[model samples]
Target: MILTADVLENAFVRLEPFEPSMRAEVRSALDCDPDSWGGMVAAAYGPHFDGWWTAAMAAMCAGSRIPWAVRRQSDGAVIGTTSLYEIRPEHRRCEVGSTFYRPETRGGPVNPACKRLLLDHAFAAGAVRVEIITDTLNPASQAAIRKLGARDEGVLARHKITWTGRIRDTAQFAILDLDWPKVRQLLDDRIAGFSES
Candidate 1:
């Protein structure tokens, strides 16, 4: 169920699946920007992520509904991670979240290019709707989703008190396949505008 045709190419980045050899690189990338989500993720899974990324990567490699991976390029350095989770075949919907990128990759073509790859893949996989949810406080991520043309569905107030004991507000966004032609065109324009030298 390789939801996507394969890796997507753009002027600055490529979104592809996590591979076995990427273990160390992924660990390295996740290690940076510790103040962001380091304690939440890396410390919990760092030592054995080689197997974890491998398993997760294998699932995506198997074309499972939740195919996911750490983002990188020909350089094989992991800069971010995202996944198509909570898939509902009957509903023709799935979520695109659990995404994080190193600070270095921010405000670069990397983020948009990665999103373009995911969105195209989801729509191309016959999904009627692809959604993304971001913590309300994470303005950067929220803005990025909006820039991609996703409509604000709603806010899940106090969605779930995290283990850290913080009540999180989630801002949801979605792009239906019906909007792909236009959204894709919009992304193309944005990517072009940003990549211009």
Candidate 2:
């Protein structure tokens, strides 16, 4: 396995290694964009997002070889990030999370392109089932995962305690290797449609 922080690249994005220097980019991405995500979801406040920052830096320093800061291949703007956390080669499973994007890149090609890149890599790495979880209250994220054709794998009740000291239920989603063909095909169609100008 290619373990030890590395960049994920493709035609659309050049995800860099997340570092302390990029803290501003990460903080800005989380802090000012959503403004409560149209009040449809509780916007991820900046202070609470430190967890993501810590994890990313740790991953870069000693964790694994896969965490990356997502950037436009064209401009290299630090727009967002994602990582393959809790990787278990024995189980061939890993959790893909800690994703955030700048407002400008949202509802655009960044997400699908990023996911397309990550999922493609994950499967190639022998990950039979890749899982992602989001807060149940975060309908927008849930909808996005569903749109990716991930199967609803039930909710993990009181899955975690938020920074606000409230218990949060997490909605889980997964796509297995067997499902990749269809999922990939679906994503291909969506991305193609996204690029049809």
Candidate 3:
């Protein structure tokens, strides 16, 4: 499917096109949890965010990724960013990663809602496979991926070094198009339950 920096929204959160104008709000919101990126590649503070934003925009410009500023729907506050990257239309596959949320928004409804939107869009775009990978050391993320109904595809040893110079073992997970029906139902049920609570 054709991917663009289109605004994507569900009941709980809104994914707006990432723009330079959104820097301050996003940075401010991310400041709510300064160490949020500890498990990931980018830093959330100081000039590091600028570097991350630049690379993100570059990927968008090159049509390799579509990034969004994740905003809480209830209050329209920027919460974090998520993207569909490594888009391979011919292969009908893409990766969902580079996601970060404000600390307070973690362990809540935001992530499930966002993933629902991204997965829905990816499959609609003719994706046969959608991947979600995390550092092997991150149990929280591993659990989240499992909850998405993605089958464990094992790990890639010495995947990539983080910004902190830590060698990471990447835990790979994926949901195939054939599995979408069941996985979508699970995510839908989770979002509904989350919305209720």
Candidate 4:
């Protein structure tokens, strides 16, 4: 079973469970600047968003995924989406992926803040491992994951079929239950830095 989609929030961001009401807000955020999703799966932006949303909704209803709409606290606008997919309750693992943000918020506190909340929730939900993977071509994504203190687990060649119909290699990273202490501190420091600036 997937973890419950409880509201997760911090000073910078709030992750709310996805629902039909968020469609317009999320669509508007993603449609603002197409470039923000350049390295991500093509469907995440542009004309394919509708199809992607449909599939995601189906997954949520199937109990295999929990989706969240990331929102900024200052204005309470949806900025992007993220999810816990491939959830395996028996194995106590899940993938904290399918994440994206608006271009202006890319290098700010939102990502780390969201990650901290998600990680905390996952571990607290009895997850022993939380995996995050990115397209191999996305160095920025790889770097961000590293900063979260997750260890690299190498690449998976031809792991996914992108929206553009290309076979893509994926870079895998993971954080085990044992690594949470240090990782949590790393995240706390990062969030503090954001608040300072």
Candidate 5:
């Protein structure tokens, strides 16, 4: 199974391959909240934005990660970004992480729509496990992952040093291939409910 980036979309959001031209727009969207970067391992706003952008592009070019610009389908506006990284085809696993969106896009169908597309793509490409890891300090992120039907796999203590030099505990979650059917249904139902409202 060769895992590669492809355009993934649903009714609410579209995940397009991240490109150099999108750097400015994506950075502007991310700059809306400096506090949003607090729980993130790497800074993505202000002075740190350039470094983050460079590394992301390098990873994509090196085939180590597949990043996407998250666009709202209604306006074709780039609201944020996400990625499938730490991919290991031999192990049939990959991580859905590095996800962030503008403040307005949170707590709506945008997230579930994006995850549904990413999960569906990974599973279809023969992935046995898809993991979503987050900073333990960020309960909002952990809760959002749980809402997607991911099983909490506990914390990884001293997981990694954050950009601010803080040792972060990572909250791990996973949805195995065996669990996909139920998770898929849950996500679909949730997105459908959003549309209904």
Candidate 6:
């Protein structure tokens, strides 16, 4: 279960290891829609952006998380960020989370394309199970996760304390290795549909 931060990409998006040089681009992409971070436990917009960026960079530097700057393939623009964290090789499990995308990239091929690449990489690295968790208040996120073929595993009460000191409940979803083949096909078909359109 060796999960390394290698470049993972597809036709629509490329997941490159997050670097300090990408700070401005990433910040600009996130600033495009401050409202988008409403449901996020950590602040990634406006006044909180600097702190969030600092902590994120620190985490990446410590090897506590494998973070990627999600780049749009067409123009190679940094549009978002995502990570593979809470990695446990002993359990052969990890989480694909801390994901965010510019509002413009939502509701299209970007998500599926990104997920397909991430999931493929995780499983290839010997992940027996991968979890995608979201704030319970974020129905849109929950819906999107469900659309990825992840099974709802209920909510964790008072799961985390947000940056604003509010207790947040988290909805848990998971896709097991046994479910990978189906999930993979579903993602591929969805991405293909976008191209077909």
> Considering every candidate listed, which one attains the maximal TM-score?
5
Candidate 1's residue-wise lDDT over 53-117, tens digit each?
66666666565534334455547666766677657677878887657678877887777777787
- lDDT string for model 4 (57-105, tens) is 8888887788899999999889888899888999999999889888778
> Model 2: residues >4 Å from true position, as ranges?
1-4, 34-52, 60-65
Residue-by-residue lDDT tens digits, candidate 3, 92-113: 8999998888777889999999
* Candidate 2, poorest ten consecutive residues by summed lDDT: 36-45
Per-residue CA lDDT of model 5 for 22-104, tens digit only, reads: 88888987787888888788989889889998998899888778989899999999999999998888899999988889998
- Candidate 3 lDDT score relative to the true structure: 0.88
- Which residue pairs clash in candidate 3? 1-125
Off by over 4 Å in 4: 35-39
Residue pairs in steric clash, candidate 6?
A: none
Error of 3 at 15 (Å): 0.5
**Candidate 1 Cα misplacement greater than 4 A, ranges:** 1-5, 38-76, 161-163
RMSD of 3: 1.3
- Poorest 10 consecutive residues of model 5 by lDDT? 29-38
TM-scores for every predicted model: 0.80, 0.83, 0.95, 0.95, 0.97, 0.95
**All candidates: CA RMSD (Å):** 3.4, 3.3, 1.3, 1.5, 0.9, 1.2
Pairs that collide in candidate 2 are 4-64, 4-65, 5-65
Compare candidates 1 and 3 on lDDT and give the better one: 3
TM-score of 2: 0.83
Lowest summed lDDT window (length 10), candidate 1: 37-46
